[model samples]
Target: MTALRTGVTALAVLLAIVLQAALLPHVGWRGVVPNLCLLVVVAGALTRGAHFGVVLGFCAGLALDLAPPADHLAGRWALALMAVGLVAGLVRRDERPTIPVVLVTAAVASFVGASVFGLLGVVTGDPGVAVTDVLLAVVAGVAGDLIVAPLVLLPLMVLLTRFEPQRRLA
Candidate 1:
């Protein structure tokens, strides 16, 4: 059962990554793309727990790093996303799993992810991106994640509940 759950979660994360990289760019608002990967990581963290969240975050970040239109320092994304996952998992401790929590976690995780990426860029002396660009992207990603969280979370919750009714019964 746990293996099945992990497989499903991994598939979901891969789908989210592909969609974010392929479809989201075309649907960008004012040049800001939503961080769908972050949403998936947060959702995974909330549902699964800290260790799974960290592993998922690392894999997702690695995928993002390897995808086309790459960024500098490959491992930066991996580390930043790991932090986001850990933080989101921590959030799950106090917050109930709901749309509100999903939205809030997405927003917060977006900010933290972008900030960590930006700081790493600076630390690496990469000339990097502009601070304003990073901040704007974070804000836009947060808004986009908040708007999309309920749509994704609702279906995910339904599917998970169907597969693991005991989870909901508890």
Candidate 2:
């Protein structure tokens, strides 16, 4: 069961990265793309826990940073997504997360992830982006993430739920 869940988690991250790399580049609004990988991390955090989310986020973000067409330093995304996972994981509940919870989490994750990445670029002297541009991207990213949260989160929630061992109430 653990192996199956790990495989599914890996597969989900891979799919999200592929989709983000292949498709979203074209469909993005004003150069601000929806972050599917971040959504996946948030889903993991919400379904599992902070530790799992952090690990998944670091892996997924590292993949994104290393993925082709990557312009920025690798560890930038690693740090950003780690923060996203930690924030999202903190919001998890014993009960299944509701739509409102998912939306809120998506919004917060989007903001934190984008801001962290942008800040890192500046701090590291990456010459990657301007503060105003990062602010704009953050706004757009949050909105875009919220719009797609249902599509990604719902299916992922179902999949994660399936992997859980049946709980027996004593």
lDDT of 2: 0.88
TM-scores for all predictions: 0.85, 0.94
Candidate 1 segments whose C-alpha is farther than 4 A from its true place: 92-95, 157-170
Model 1 has how many clashing residue pairs? Answer: 0
Best by the lDDT measure: 2
Q: What clash count goes with each model?
A: 0, 0
The Cα error of candidate 2 at residue 146, in Å, is 1.0
Task: Quote the lDDT for 120 in model 2.
Answer: 94
Clash pairs for candidate 1: none
In model 1, the worst 10-residue window by lDDT is: 161-170
| lDDT to native, each model | 0.76, 0.88
Model 1 lDDT per residue over 72-96, tens place: 7798888888988888878746545
